[model samples]
Each structure stands twice: as structure tokens, then as C-alpha cells.
Target: MIGEPMPDPRRSIIDNLNQQLDAFFGAGKSVQVIPSGVSADAPFFGTNSHQLKLRAERDKLAPAVRAEAAKGVVASVAAKNLRMHVKRVTLIAQENGFRFADNP
Candidate 1:
């Protein structure tokens, strides 16, 4: 496993959506995807018998979302076009689940 690259985090749906909301409205404006009408572990079951919800964070999420990117070291790549980025992670996840869904 030496020299193997670590998985990119920005490619995550939730992270992208959060960044989008933040880019649109500024930090703390980001939202989180929570399990709705379903247990927290429902996604592990591979069942469509659950629901997901997007909720705005009541506290500051800037640190959580921007820290890795803002760090001035080699880890700073996240701050770049990575410049941009989930979710509405559930909605996107659903789209991944049901690919035929319309974007609009």
C-alpha cells in the first residue's frame, strides 16, 4: 500500500453540496443530510424503505468544512477548485440510486 494515494474527500456528494451552499450564502449556511423516516443505519441495509432530510446547522460548520482546505500545508488542495465542491447528500445519493431522475 506504499505510495498509494488517499481517497479524495471533495468527491463526496455531501461535501460538495455543503460547499455549494456555503459558496452561495457563506459559511454556517451549509446544511447536513440526516436520516428521516429511517434509522441512522438504514443506508447499510440496501433498502429503499427509508427517507433522508437536509437540515441547516444550528452552529458554525465553517471549521469542519473549511479547515482541511484552509490549512496552509500540502493538505490545502481541498481549498482549490476542489475550487468548489454535497448535499443534500441524500438527494444526490438518491440520484445515484435512481440515476434516471431529472436534474431539474
Candidate 2:
């Protein structure tokens, strides 16, 4: 049994961000639209050098994707931290039986 609360807001926020990323990257669809005449196994390059070049390009772009994902993770962590701080403050006030009454 994990000693954590159920439905953790942080996890939910992260999950939402990941879903948005999937939509952004089009992970649900084909990477490239193949023409009707093109077969799935068709080679993208006639030479190994061309294939290696494409692979290198993909590797270069991977870092940017990771950076974006890191941003989302940071945001979710910040939100969770803020929520926890607020909850602690509220608990402290409740324990002290503090009350605010506006008087004009």
C-alpha cells in the first residue's frame, strides 16, 4: 500500500501534459503519410550514408523533445508543491482555530 493519497493531482497533471505531447508529436498516427503506391518496406535511401544522415537528424531533434517534456514535468511538480504548501497553511490555521472577521 502506497502511503500516498489517491488521485494525486500531480500525477494527473503530468498525465495530461503527456497526452498533449502525444497529440503534438502525432504519436497516434503514422510518422509519414505513405502514398498509395508506396509499400511499408520501401527504403528511404539508396545508400547507407543517406540513411545515417536521416538518423542523425532525428537524434538532433530528440533533445528538443526531451527539453519540452522536462518543462511539463517541472510545471507539474511546481503545482503539486504549491498545493501542498497551501494545505499545510490551512492545517496550521485550523489547529490554531484562527478566524477572520471583517469589521467596517
Candidate 1 residue 26 Cα shift, in angstroms, is 2.4
Candidate 2 stretches with Cα past 4 Å from truth are 1-47, 73-104
**Pairs of colliding residues, candidate 2:** none
For residue 49, model 2's alpha carbon misses the true position, in angstroms, by: 1.7
Give me the displacement of residue 79 in model 2, in angstroms. Answer: 24
**True-structure Cα RMSD, model 2:** 30.8
Tens digit of lDDT per residue, candidate 1, span 1-80? 99999777767877889878778777445556866676564465443443322223312333443443234322223323
Give the C-alpha lDDT of model 1.
0.41
**For residues 2-102, could you state the per-residue lDDT of candidate 2 as single tens digits?**
89668988999999999888897885664667677677566654546776775565455444334433344432342254443434333333334442222
